[model samples]
Target: MLIKKAVLDGIASGDIDLLFRTWDAERVHAGSTQRTAIGVLAVDAVEETDPAELTEEDARRGGYASLDALRHDAETRDGTLYRITLHLAGEDPRIALRAEIPRGRELTALRDRVLHMGDWAVPTLEMIAAQPGVRAPDLAAQAGREKRPFKASVRRLKELGLTESLAVGYRLSPRGKAVLSAVRRATASA
Candidate 1:
């Protein structure tokens, strides 16, 4: 089920409102191209279904049933999510989605990196997670920096795969959530 790039981009970035708007626009603009029937149904289900549930059937049907369900599936199937995002982007893309880190040595390494980011990085990531749809300019204002530098700093977080860029701003990756939790637990116990 091929969804348009704008729609996938919106969903990945937690822009459900934008997604709805874009979906409706596409449905209205449904002129020449023969739309994929299942894709339309899946998006409709996402729009209509309250208390949505994911199932093997939904997977086979090949699209998300709801924004929550999509987020859940993204956490569980990060590679697939990433690939879909990349595919939607088309051509060589600068940014890509990433899978969460596995445990043991990699986790330990990441923890060390996180700890050594001079205290600000984790907190920044936490802030981004807390404000899901906030834009970069707003975040820069909050951080008391000009937008360009603040955006560059956020890009650094993206390089670590600890955060993702949305159409508007940013969200922590699943790995980011895990690292934040681990760090909190470690600090709390200490």
Candidate 2:
């Protein structure tokens, strides 16, 4: 549904090809070929519908309730999907009405211990920050953890809007960098 929202938001007035291409580019970047096909199908389902004429049913058949609903969800979201919307909107001025998704609530439990010598703190965030563009296995190795758990930690951070996925690896998001800085300061002071 988030994908559907992004696709709809990115679709210029009548430009199905442009929408498909944008979705394809994003999906390819994420390396989700299956998701790319799904997004393409959604776009195809409404290739003939103009943006202004888009109705509730059109949005549903496009896998959403309405453009309004999509906008609402996008507005409330603060993860990779929302970030992609921001990026696409920057790339194409025709994409409009994209609301910024602010960083989610702080992980209170993680505040003091974020950089402490622990299982899920210093290692995960430090490695990702130090090696912003490395693959998961390399990051895991550098962090002295295995591939599976390190990936899980990354996913957890992503769910908190603290990290983002790339085609090949992951990187701390703007929110991630801020939180990390705060964590460092807090830990140092402690």
Candidate 3:
């Protein structure tokens, strides 16, 4: 479920508590948390709902100006209508993780993890570092890999706090730079 930046801001501000999506199946469950640029959102409930059953208040809580606007937007997608109740959970842990530079055991563990990602890891990091705001397809073409797998690889790096997604592309986080330096030194010695 992709929440828009505006809606995310609303969630963070406690002004929004509901989300409506059209999906073939439920994409999120009650208790599942989604990390967004703003922070983390905790899903409190997920239930099938009829558009007509949705009240104007529901629209407001969902960040829509009116029920008609909500219905209009929901109708644009094809799937079962699901009403999701949610709240801002907390800060995205990655925010903290991306800021911290690893050392000693942690550094070694992170380096090993990157090495296990195969030959593409270091090069990908270097490429992102070199061209911080390039589009993914362009980066993928430069790397001679398909866009999907390349994106997945980047996501893995992001999970490790070694990358930050930009509005258009990505850049190495502080942790990423530290890890990359450590990895380069270790590989050079080996």
Candidate 4:
């Protein structure tokens, strides 16, 4: 209810803090304004950021120091989290609704629940299950589709309650793991 939207300018390559802030997203001309919701909490780990308007250094100034700094910052701001949506002013010219994990929330767990279900919830879960560590775009590439399909699939998976995200690409829920495990076991038994 007390949500304040923000933007970190000049973000070239960086990561998202999927801990506290959880932006309710829509992919418009700016970041995440497509009138869509992914329901997953995922932070982007920018590796090669290059926004036409924003720069990588600008990203660092906005709120990305290092693992330790980010963790400390998020930990301290957990209660007063400010949701942010990341967008680049580069070729894309539109910002992706970055994250809502800022410093506080009315129901933190709810935000977590939404984040648990991400842009590519199911595939992302499988990728994480297989690799335990992967990237969002990697999942997208593996999905063999463009950005929208990959992002949308993950959103669907989140809507289905099978997966959620936390900064990392994605992880399986108890239900998801159970299902995956069952499938694996059945295949092995067969």
The candidate that achieves the highest lDDT relative to the unseen native structure: 3
lDDT tens per residue, model 1, 21-74 = 212212322212222211221222223221234344433333446556654644
lDDT tens digits by residue: candidate 2, 1-190: 2445455443432322222111211343331222231222222221222234445554453345457864455445343221211122223211111121333454444454355436676568777888888999988887778999888878667655667777778777766677787778766877
Clashing pairs in 3: none
What candidate 1 gets wrong by more than 4 Å, as runs, is 1-97
**Model 4 score (lDDT):** 0.43
| Model 3 spans with C-alpha error above 4 angstroms | 75-77
The regions of model 2 sitting more than 4 angstroms off are 1-118
Q: Which ten residues in a row have the lowest lDDT in candidate 4?
A: 92-101
What TM-score would candidate 3 get against the native?
A: 0.92
Q: Rate the local accuracy (lDDT) of all candidates.
A: 0.55, 0.51, 0.93, 0.43
Pitting candidate 2 against candidate 4, the one with the higher lDDT is 2
What lDDT tens digits, residue by residue, belong to model 3 across residues 31-82? 9988888888899999999887989999999999989999998888998999
Q: State the weakest 10-residue window (summed lDDT) of model 3.
A: 33-42
Name the candidate, 1 or 4, with the larger TM-score value: 1
Clashing pairs in 2: none
